[model samples]
Target chain A: MGIGPVAAQLEALLFVAAEPLPLPRLSAAVGLPERQVRTALVELAAHLEAGGHGIALSEIAGGFQLLTRPEHAAVVAALQAPRSAPLSKAALETLAIVAFRQPVTRATIEELRGVQSEGALATLVDRGLVAEAGRADSPGRPFLYATTRQFLEHCGLRSLEELASLANLPPAVTQVQPLPGWRTPARGAAGPEAATPDA
Target chain B: MGSDDRGGGVPEKGACQAPEPGLESVWSGLDAGTLAPDDVRVEALVGQQREVAADLEDATAAVVQLSRVLEAKARALLPTPVAPEAEGGEPGAEPDADDADLAERVAAYQAFAEAAALLRSYEESRALRFGRPQPESKTRRPAPSPAGAVSLEDLLTALSQVWERARPRTRDVTRERLTVGQVVARLRTRLSRLGSIEFEELFPSDADRFEVVVTFLAVLELVRLGEARAQQPHPFQALRLAWSGPEAESR
Candidate 1:
């Protein structure tokens, strides 16, 4: 019931967890009330900060997680193997658009880039950076995509609200201009424009 | 060819008469009432018979070519008859005899298919070269769309249905009980080779919660036995399993 033991238990659970741990799961695991767990989390964060530990406790994606401090990221990368290939420029741009204008359809992303972006969109989805938020109520019921929790973790942000303002983005990304020469790889001859709304 | 070269026709029948050069004259002769309907019908039959003969000749040539290809394939499939080697040679000198046989079989089939394809393509190319004018690649106009063209939305809907059909039909299978010992042996073997692996990677993607619990128990068992060590480098990270054998300890 003490804060010290609860904090130790929270730290162990967080260390072994593959994803961020929510308050409910943490409380259930420790067999303590949610209020006690919250206090312990604060205690643990303070303890880690005071002790100058490489790992820091942070709230991310609506859950508590232990993540390596930004200062130690370089050393950690040197130790850990690369998880996967870095996202391409196109994929990153698409991710940024989704993060900002979320619940947005593929058509909107293409309009922003001025190029066909199905490939980049698919890559982001595959990497778990973006996910289907839902279908648009509009014609054809196109799938609307948004940044996922993994995206926040990847970007080292706590939530969508913490995202860098759109003003920071380059003018090319914010403006709409259809690219003439660039073409979709799979079906270049028949672009997205060729698709018509279903009757 | 001239009517004379085409051979003499029956004099009684006007259509069969060797009276003119060119098919136009023959048609004109019919239209002018110089040739009777029966004579024209007889002439048409003769023309059809000649075409049939030419087609038959081509078909026979194709049959012969196919037969030769089959014969070669049959010969290749049969095991080669090896003669006795000189006394100095070892009997089992060929270590990869089975592999070699498999490779030969694969290569033989590949070569057979390739040779047949190449022959057909070569024939087609020659016909194209002599029979018609080559198409201008750059100047070629795009083909007109067929009437009632399906939109991509329809195509995607159809594809979704096809994909739905192509999916493996899930059957209601009874859950099998996974034992801790089984997972321990499996984990130990993997750890011995990999030296270290992430805990999340221990189980398959589709592993059930029961299986995961059993596997976690097995991991604890290995740790208790000093066979493996589990550590998490950072919070929210997967537990890393490292082999704690003597060599690993020294390293």
Candidate 2:
């Protein structure tokens, strides 16, 4: 199909898609050339703007999706009851370690926490609180975790520095002397179940 | 009577010559009248000289003793580590000059190393306080684009791109259109209900009053097209938007 029809078809596809669809997947689903799909998305985005419903089609995180205008947040919140939950202790700890020790492996997290955190990590991923930022440059090249924007939102932070200040938390264990100079991780430390103080 | 006797005693022939003119004259001219008793004066001067000499000797001895005492005290009070080179040498053997110098250099280096380590740790701690790691450079390089050069359009575009990239997906299958008015209405409703929203999505652009205008229009358009939806699942929670479906009408 030409750019016009391809753009129209892609827009149609995004309009019905449940989730933000990756460009490759969208291209495959529409059975159109990738370049054409990209051009169509741009054109369709402009067309959407021209129509003036305030919504726009755009690509995010390597995917194409439709989103509401930002100014409408309060309206949406009123219509849909907020379902967000405060971060769990384990999630907080995991986020901290990831922020301060970014490009760190899961094994390192286990070492710091002194326990297996496979389940907690999964929960964080499901919540979009953390993501596989990249692979470590070690022997195994293990997947490394990092806090996502969602994590920042949960903490009510504008940047990592804001979160870092929050980390001056009391140590998980009371009796142990908190490392005199250790700053809390950028995301704050976890509780005893997920964190341990140095002996 | 004494004068003639004393004269006769000096020498019999000389005494008899009656005091020759020159000799008599010289003796008569002498200042014996003003002189103290010669014997007593001599004895007193001699005694004084001896006393001075004795005092000098005592002072010198005391000075020497004081110097010795000071040297001993200094040796005792100053820390004296065994010289590394000297420890292996015999009592009479002179230590190697090179070894002594090396030991001094090593000690100096060790002191320097300790000072450097302390400085590094101090810097690290300071960095932690400000929510930063130790800076690799003392000053940061300036950004490529000067802050003054950034226009409102640039900022809005950046913000828009970020929102486009970072927003999450919705689980529902029904598409919704969002317009600027709809979005504003949604936010106003949510705010009146005391609900919060993702702060980023709430103010996604840097365009002053225009952002509010544009985004409101955009959201209403979105609602009309059925590409997105406003959500408030709870009273205390903030309003949020989610992708409803892909069947949203084309704008």
Candidate 3:
């Protein structure tokens, strides 16, 4: 079918594309100039908003994509009740560090989490979420890790940029966490329940 | 340790003198001729026994030290235990919890990570795009290769495999005559009759890099205009190219 409007053409491309569409690529795909495409994208975002559509345009990672509004997270979650369990707390934290501060080394991640994370790092690697982006310039040439495209897809993010403006989630718990001492905090009454799954 | 003062030989069995109670087993351990040394002097024997005892004590101490080190290492490898109040605590001050159950912490952290990934997955899947649907899982069952059964990755990989193989020079030889345009025409004709052809089978066994490159570019042209499509049943498997439709006549 012929592209009716420039904005509609852009939406059609983003809708079918597996990843976010950047300006140049969108321009090439739609046979329009980059400047014109950029303006059309803005108009498209406003168009979706003004029309009160369920989906809206967002700038994430380094491209433009269409995603549902945040207000519909609950309904969407219900529709897609978690298929698998969440990753370990360590994996999640490691993922957060990799997502935000990518091209980082194990040493940097360890420093951020305040704990040795060989196992956690290994788990993330095995799961295909974290990957060795490259070797660091420092001594011994330690491997630097970064989140993979699979990670972006897994997190439901169009791009890393989309992850930036999230409001509800607390900052990744990077501060070196205090470990439970031998002296029970006089508060493990539910310790069995909470620690069982973890155990 | 000192040189023997008396004869170092043992007396005949019947003529032997009384020995210390604990030394009875030690004496019997020596063979009749195997006593190789004399037991006539007790002081030297006592020194030897003391040396053996000290060696045993040293070995036991080493083992204890090694076990302690291993325990410390095992503790260090475990996940950080939950200390909710310590969320924003000191930066580098890591606690040494003597009773930390590392396995438990790892398990807890694992659960937490799984939860995060699940939530993240849900969040991203929002406003699901309607496009080409993913291949059905039931299709994962074994099936013979058929038309329209090939995946996009397999098709691209086959093309890439040809492209990558063409990059490395097999030998020092230079003879270039074909052009991308000529090869494109030849490729279109070769694939014209056969609905599809396996990537490698299309070429002669002796086809060199140059010929392959020319042929590859032609294939790219044909596929670009939807005149032809490639198929691959599995990644890196044989690649096949087929005409897009009956209406595809040579341009």
Candidate 4:
């Protein structure tokens, strides 16, 4: 049959939304319970898919938004605009590390790659793939970085769960856990569990 | 000293300007024909010549000494054992010629490597035109991390930052607080029962830090408006507050 009034309202609201709209906000606006609104979003996503519409609903960036299908990228490119140039090699590697080990800090990345990654981190953040999640609880309050939903979209992964395990890399990669300069990756001179002077 | 030696020696400015008394007398004798003696004039001229020759000898020795010192210094300044290769290159080239060459070679190699990679990428991408425009997704690049010359202080700062971010954020859940108006009303009610009350009594045991602060402020405001009187028994003592009479209120 036709789309229900609640589902139709959700579609219209999401279409007009510039940012992702959470279920609670959508439910509040539609005067329905959050569970009902969530079910409606599910049915709405499926209905759009069944109808073979160019636009589809996807939950991203902690909320739901309408996006053009991947098959329509070339068509949308014609309608919208060309994508920007790709990130540099340094940026890609940094992004991979961030995507795999999210809520990470630049220091930790530097220790792992045996390099300073401020510039790469900044680039990934600018591209909207990696973002500042929060400040670490340690001194200087360095920002903790996490992969954005845009990161998954960029990688063509549905979620972080789909990220290929970095476990395949040397046992050393996982051993480089969080700490001061976390000096184990490059400077594997010291044992991974070596204590910091302050500790 | 010979009389002819005067002409051989370089003349001194002071000697030229002012002749010696004996020489002047000799010249005057010659000019005025008073002494009428050519021998005296010859002797005086010989004496002056002798003096000038001695001064010239001393000056020449000084010049030789100064020349020797300057030559020694110049020898010391010359880059000893200058590399033949450096000398053959452009005159006054940078001392570290090898470093400069290495830098140039590195830059050229980097350019060539980048161009080669681009050519390969272009060929690879041309085949998969329909694929998503995700750049460099599968092709892993070597980590271009620097010499990881991180200092201990920097590492510690970074470590602390990591630890701090990982620390659980104490999400302070705030509760409803009594406003100044509410505190004032409550204080007034409390004071009505007891004509005077201790300042500490305003804060009930259940009162949180915020409530205590608000209650204290409310008490100060009441006293400021002359609505109440707060008196301390002595310095560093608990303050007692009472209702201000009409006189205190008028003030």
RMSD of each: 36.0, 40.8, 28.5, 30.4
The local distance difference test score of each candidate is 0.57, 0.46, 0.55, 0.54
Q: Which candidate number maximizes TM-score?
A: 3
Prediction 1 global C-alpha lDDT: 0.57
Q: After best superposition, candidate 1 residue B59: deviation in angstroms?
A: 55
Model 3 Cα lDDT, one tens digit per residue, B1-251: 11232233345567765433222232222212333223333444444445544344333322332333334345445675655455578643555555345333433333333335544554345334322222455223222111123435557889998998786658877667778888777777777767678988767688898778777888888889787898996898888988774555552
- The second chain of candidate 4 has a TM-score of 0.33
Point out the higher-scoring one by TM-score: 2 or 4: 4
Q: Better model by DockQ, 3 or 4?
A: 3
Alpha-carbon deviation at A117 in model 3, angstroms = 2.4
Candidate order by decreasing TM-score: 3, 1, 4, 2
State interface RMSD in Å for all models. Answer: 27.4, 24.2, 18.9, 18.6
Q: Please give the lDDT score at residue A178 for candidate 2.
A: 24
Q: In candidate 1, which residue pairs clash?
A: none
Candidate 2, CAPRI quality class derived from DockQ = incorrect
Top of the candidates by lDDT: 1
User: Model 2 reaches what TM-score against the true structure?
Assistant: 0.28
Identify the candidate with maximal DockQ. Answer: 3
- Per-residue lDDT tens digits of candidate 1, residues B120-187? 33223222211112145411422211111343455789999999889687889987767999999999
Return the lDDT, model 1, position B4: 30
TM-score, structure 3 vs. true: 0.37
The sequence of per-residue lDDT tens digits that candidate 3 reaches over residues A65-100 is 776677875776566543334565456657776665
User: For model 2, how does the per-residue alpha-carbon lDDT over A51-131 read when each residue is reduced to its tens digit?
Assistant: 775566744323456755545556655664443444444444455565555544688765654446677678766765566
Can you tell me which runs of candidate 2 are displaced by over 4 Å? A1-3, A86-93, A96-199, B1-251
Q: Encode model 4's per-residue lDDT on B1-251: one tens digit a residue.
A: 11222222223445663343333243233334443332243434454545643344333322332333233334435655444455457644555565345434333322322332332343233222222233464223222121232435567899999998896778878787679889888877667656678877778889888888888899988888776888887999888998673444333
